[model samples]
Target: MLKDSFGRVATDLRVSLTDRCNLRCSYCMPPEGLQWLPKPELLTADEIMRLVTIGVERLGITEVRYTGGEPLLRRELVEIVQRTAALTPRPQVSLTTNGIGLERLAAPLAEAGLDRVNVSLDTLDRDVFIRLAHRDRLADVLSGLEAAHRAGLAPVKVNTVLMRGVNDHEAAALLRYGMKHGYQQRFIEQMPLDAQHGWKREDMVTADEILAMLGKEFDLTPADPRERGSAPAELFLVDGGPYRVGVIGSVTRPFCGACDRVRLTADGQIRNCLFAREESDLRTALRSGASDEELAERWKAAVRGKRPGHGIDDPTFLQPSRPMSAIGG
Candidate 1:
């Protein structure tokens, strides 16, 4: 196991295949998106597989998650999942997507060996969805969730970002909808990953607020925190309901101490933390004919230098140079 200076073992690797996305969420990016990485600058499917192999075999990464501006946007996604699943001690594979293109790709991805899927659905109302995502594709997202469920992606999770006055009112409804469809619902507190850097604590909804809202609708019992493993979400069971809901309090309640994640940006930068001001460029080394062992060493060095936490509450904390989409949320 690769243990960082803080004694946190690196076990989860999030590979961002591309910095391109189909939707432009107001909080994530501008309505007219920012300049994207040129196609030539992005990592190829083969290169991603090689990195995954090194992370799995050499670095002992046990879980591999494909993230992106939207992961499904990658044409070679299924192939990537297939190759990841074929590893010796095959790491559990999953994806985090916007659900826009998932209707067509969900089944194919499951067939290709993806173990699970997490769809980002902030609201069920068509107008609200459109206003938030800058797209009128609520029906498509609904279909995608259903497709993922039909494809045997059990406990398909829904990631809902709660913006104070925005869609925070939909908390109970979203949880109920997920419960009805057998999706594990996770309410995420909005973070400072917005491209606009307009995140305000006053406008952000918190995990405590979400739980208080849910309390009015259903009974909730705190679950064993140990079951959370390396997941960022804090788990809780809906009192009498069949499923549970989780809250990722990245801002108000930071989980940085237990973070075991290392991200590979689409442009090939290795980020030790999402909010880290600096990144190590692995693309340059890779193109220079660096061996797999050398690449692994770089990865290890990056993790070894992982900071103790993402200082969201610190007065001097600065938003990252890149947005969530570019950094692979």
Candidate 2:
């Protein structure tokens, strides 16, 4: 098992397949998006598979999450999932997508051994969705979620980033929509990961505020906590309801101590934390024909120095140099 200095075992690996996204989310990337990494620089499917194999075989990683500026935009995504699923222990495979492209790809991805999906859907209001995502694809996203559910991706999850005075007003409505469609909604507090570096503490909707907003419409109870796991969301049951909602208070109530995940950008840089200021370049080493053992050692070195916490509440906290799109959500 790969245990960091803080004793947090690394079990989850988030791989960003591409830095190009169709939508320019206000809280994620700049309006102009970004100059994406050249295709030649992006890690190939074989390289990604090799890294996943090493993580699973050597580092005790058991969960492989495919992320991106939008993972669905990656052409080889299903192939990546298929290969990762074929590993010895067969790590649980999942994806986080914007859902605009999911309607066409969900069934194929599910058939390729994807375990589940977390779709980004911040609002059902067309105007709000357009204003936030810089796209008018709310209906497309909704259809994609339904497609994923129909394809047997059980318990499809929705990731809603709540920005104060923006989409926070839709808290109850979003929850109700998820509940109605049998989707588990997870409200995430906007962090300092925006491309513009414009995150303000007062603009973030905290977990407490999210609960309070939902309390206006439903009776919620703390759900029985699952086994201590790497997944970040904290779950809660809607009183008298069949489904539950989750809250990832990344900023206000950071879960740094229990973090067991590491990240790999599309360009093959290993980031120990979402807010990590530094990253180890894995692409150069991989292209240099480094042996699997050597690659595994590189991963270990990165984890050994993982920061204890994100320091979101610290007065001296600084936003990451790269935006969420480049770092992978």
Q: Would you list the clashing residue pairs of candidate 1?
A: none
Q: Pick the candidate with the highest TM-score.
A: 1
Q: Where is model 2 poorest over a 10-residue stretch in terms of lDDT?
A: 222-231
TM-score for each candidate, following the candidate numbering: 0.98, 0.97
lDDT of each: 0.89, 0.89
Tell me each candidate's RMSD, in Å, in order: 1.0, 1.2
Q: Give the per-residue lDDT digits (tens) of candidate 1, residues 26-66.
A: 88998999899999999899888988899999999999999
lDDT of 1 at 3: 78
The digit string of per-residue lDDT tens for model 2 on 111-206 reads 999999999989989999989988889999999999999999877999999887778889999988888888989999888898888888887888
